[model samples]
Target chain A: MSALRIALFLILFSFALANENPDAHVFPRPLVIEYPENIEPRFDDEVRLKCASWRFAGEANNLNPWKTIPEECAGYVKDYMTGKGYESDLLRASEEAGVYAQNVELGGDGKDVWVFDVDETLISNLPYYYEHGFGLEVFDSVEFDKWVEKGVAPAIKSSLKLYQDIKRLGFKAFLLTGRSDRHREVTVENLKNAGFQDWDKLVLRLPEDHVKSATTYKSEKRSQMVEEGFRIVGNSGDQWSDLLGSSMSQRSFKLPNPMYFIP
Target chain B: MSALRIALFLILFSFALANENPDAHVFPRPLVIEYPENIEPRFDDEVRLKCASWRFAGEANNLNPWKTIPEECAGYVKDYMTGKGYESDLLRASEEAGVYAQNVELGGDGKDVWVFDVDETLISNLPYYYEHGFGLEVFDSVEFDKWVEKGVAPAIKSSLKLYQDIKRLGFKAFLLTGRSDRHREVTVENLKNAGFQDWDKLVLRLPEDHVKSATTYKSEKRSQMVEEGFRIVGNSGDQWSDLLGSSMSQRSFKLPNPMYFIP
Candidate 1:
C-alpha cells in the first residue's frame, strides 16, 4: 500500500473505533454483542461521569448495598468488566500483592498464610454475570448457587499467577470464601479444574455461619485461624467486606469488581 | 454548512481529538500545556494500565508509603489530577455524603458532629501540587508550609458544598487536619477566604501530636470527641489515615486525592 493510502486507512479505522467508544482507549474492548438498532445506549458525558463515580465510591466503600448497577451504568459496567481497564486493574493489584508477598520474611513454621476470596478474586463468575445483565439485575443466590453447581467458572489468570507466586514464597494459601459447606465438593472440583491446587485449606461457611454478615463471618473465621496459629500475612478480595474487620491480614489487596457489591 | 461539509468537519475534529487523548471521553480534559520537544510521553497500553492499577491499589489502601509517583506514571498522574475524572470522582463521593446526611437522624443537642480533613478534603492544594509535578516530587514539609502560609489554597467546590449541606442537616462540621498548630492562623484565614465558616472547631496538631502518626493523632482526637459527648456521625478525608482506626464515624466518605498520599 502507498504511504498516503495507508494513512487514509488508519484514519477511517480510528474513526469507526472512536464512534463505538466515546472514551476510546488504546486497549479496545470488544463489544459483547452489538446493540440492536437504535436501542444502543448513547453514553454522553454525564452518564459516564455518574457511572464512573458510583464505581469509585463502591471501591472505596462509600457506596454500599446497591441492589443492582445503576440503570445508566449498565452499558458502562459492561464495557469496563470486559475491557483492558478491568484486566489491568486486576493485574495491578496482583502485581502489588506479589511484590509485598516477596518482601515479607515468613516464619518457617508453615503457619503463615495468605487468604484469597474465591468468586471474582480468583475464578471470575463473569459468564454468570453476563447471562444476568452485568450487574443490572438484582442478585439471586439460589440461581447463582445453581450456576456454582455447574462448577465451570474460569480462572482469573493474573490472580491465579499471584496465588501461585505467593504460595511459592512460603506462604500457606487459604481459600476463604462465603460459599457454604454444601458446595464444598463442587467448589474444590471447580478450583482444581481452574488450576488452583495445594491450597492449605479451603474455608467455607458452616451452617451456623450464614446468619452473620460477610465481614463478621470472615473475621470470626480468621480469628479461628489465628487461634490455630495461622498468621494471615496477605489478603486479597474483590469486596471490602472480605478484607475488613478484626483479625485481618498484614496487607490487603482489593481486586476490581464493578459487577456487584457483596455488602 | 451543507450536510456533507458538516460531516467532513466532524471527522476532522474527532481525528484531532483522538490523536490527543487515546481514551478520548466525551468529558474532555483541557491540556495544561503543550509538551516541548521530544519529551511528550507516549502513554502506551502498558503505562496506562500500570499507573491506573497503582491508583486502584492506593485508593484501596493496598499500596502505601511511597515517596513519589513512579517516574513512568508522572504524566498519568498529571492527567488524572487535572482531568474531569478526578472532579467527577469527588462529586460522586460528595453526592453520596449529602444523601446519607439527609437521612441521618441527628440529635438536636449540637453534639452530632461530622469530621472533615482539611487539605485535599475541604481546601485543595492543587496549585501547590501542580507546581511540584503532581506528587512526582518527594513531599517537603518546609516548602509545603510555605504554601499553606500564603493561605490562598482554593476550596474543593464539591466538598465545601457538602460541608454546608450536611451542616444544614444538623451535623456540626469539625475540621480535623494533620497540619501543626503553627499554621492555624493562616489555615483559618485560608478556610474563611475559601468560603468556609461556622465550623464547630478547627483541630490541628499539637506539640505532643508532632510525634504521633496521622492515624494515631486523629484516632486519639476522635476518641476525645466521643468522651466530650460529641457523636461523630460522619467523617471525610482524602487519606486513608484520616478514616482508618478506632472511633471513626457512623459513616466515612473518601474524596479522591491522587495528587498525594498523606501517609
Candidate 2:
C-alpha cells in the first residue's frame, strides 16, 4: 500500500480509538490520493498544477458532458470545494451578478426575471458530494435523489445573498432546476429552509423532458418564458447547460462547481 | 511604498547590482500587488483564493470586455502565466483538443478544417505581456504594434504540437485571427518561425472590419469558411469570442487566458 493509504489508515484508527465515527465521510476521504500513472510522486506540485489546469479547462466548457472529476483532480476539487477557494469563487460570481443586476434597467412591468439553478448554485451539494469521493466516483442519481428528498442541504451563502439582492432590485427570481417533478415538494422545502423565499417560479423537469439535454431543455423553457413576454436579465447556474443556447439571459452567471458537470 | 513595492524594488536593485538588466520585464513585473483595497495582507490565503476565483470567473466568460487583471490578482496572474500553471493549462487544453481531433471522422473530401486563433492561441505573447504588467495594465495597441512588427513571438509549445497533430490527422488548418491585414506579413513570418507551416488559409481582419467585435468578426469569417464548403471540425482559441456565436465548429476548445480579455 502507498504511504498515503497508510497515513489515512492510521488517521482512521486514531478516530476509532477515540470511539468516534470511522466512516470515510467522518474523516476526509482519501480522494485521488494515488498519483496519476505518469507522474512521479515527488512531483506533487505538478499534480496540483495539472488539477488546476483541468479545472480551468472544465470551466472553459472544454470538458463538456464530463461525468465526474478526474482522479487526478479529486483532491484538488475537495480542497477547493471545502476551503476558501469555493467560497470566494461563489462570492465573486454573485458579486458580479449583483453588480450586473444593479445596472440593468428593469422594465417596470415586472417582466424581468433572473434564473437560478437550484443545485450547487443556490444550495450547497457539498454535504452529498462530500460523501461521494468529491466527484472521483461517477455520479449516482439514485443516491442523489435520496439526498434531495432529505431536504437538508444548506444554502450556498453567496447565492442566497444574490437571490435576495436581485429580488430586492425588482427582478423576479425563477428557480429552474433539473430535479424531476416528483421531488418538487422536498426541493421546495429544502430551498425555503435554506433561506430562499418568494421565488416567482420553481420549474422542475417533466417526465417528457428526460430525454432532452439540459441545454436544450433549459433553452426551450426560457424560450417559453420569452414567448410569455418575460425578459430574462440574468441567469446563474453551476452548469453551462443552464446558461447557454437560444433565449439565454442578457447576462449569464456561472458559479464554480468543479465536482460534477451535468451536460 | 507598500512592502511588496519595496521588495520588488530591492529585487530589481539586486539585479542591477550584478550589472543585469533592470528592465521590468527582465525582472518579473509586480502585477496586482495591491490587496484590492479590502483584504488584510495577513490573510494571504484569502487573497490567493479570491484571485483563483477571479481567474475561474474570467474563464467562464463572466468578465467580458475586461481591460486588466484585478489589482488583487496581478501577482497571481503573473505567477500563473509564468509558472507551471500556465504550462499545464496549455497542456490540458491541447491534450483535450488532440483527443477530440483524433476521434472526428474525416469527410475524406479534404474539407475538414480546424480553426486556430493566432495571438496567445497558436503563439506565445508572454514576451510582450511580461513587459506589460502581465495584463495588470490596460492593453496598449501602439506598444503591441511595435512588438508585432518585431516578429519574435514564439510558439505556444503544446498548441504547436496539436496544430501538427490535427494537420497530420487529415484536417486542414485555418489560421483565423483578429490581427489586422497590415500585420499579416510579420504575423506570417512569426508563425512560420514559431514552427507553424502548411496552413490552408491565414484569415486576418480587414480595415473595414476594424470596428467589429472579435466574436462578430470571427463568426463572419467562419461563416464565410462554411460558405466556401470547408467543414470546421474544431475551433481553438484563448478567447470566448474566438469560440462562440454562429457557425462555430463541431467542437470548440478554449485555452486558458486570464491575462487579458477580448470582447
DockQ of each: 0.42, 0.51
lDDT of 2 by residue, A161-231 (tens): 78999999999999899999999998887787767899999999999999999998999999999999999
lDDT of 2 at A55: 87
DockQ for model 2 equals: 0.51
User: lDDT of model 1 at residue A49?
Assistant: 77
Q: What is the lDDT of residue A106 in candidate 2?
A: 82
Q: State the lDDT of candidate 1 residue by residue for B122-142, as single tens digits.
A: 877776787799898999989
- Per-residue accuracy of model 2 over B118-192 as CA lDDT, tens digit each: 998988677678778889888889999987886766667778789999999999999999999999998988788
Clashes of each: 0, 1
lDDT of each: 0.80, 0.79
lDDT of 1 by residue, A62-166 (tens): 884677988889888877776677877887788888888888888999999999999999887876787799898889999999778876666677787898898
| Model 2 stretches astray by more than 4 angstroms | A1-43, B1-43
Candidate 1 runs further than 4 Å off: A1-42, B1-42
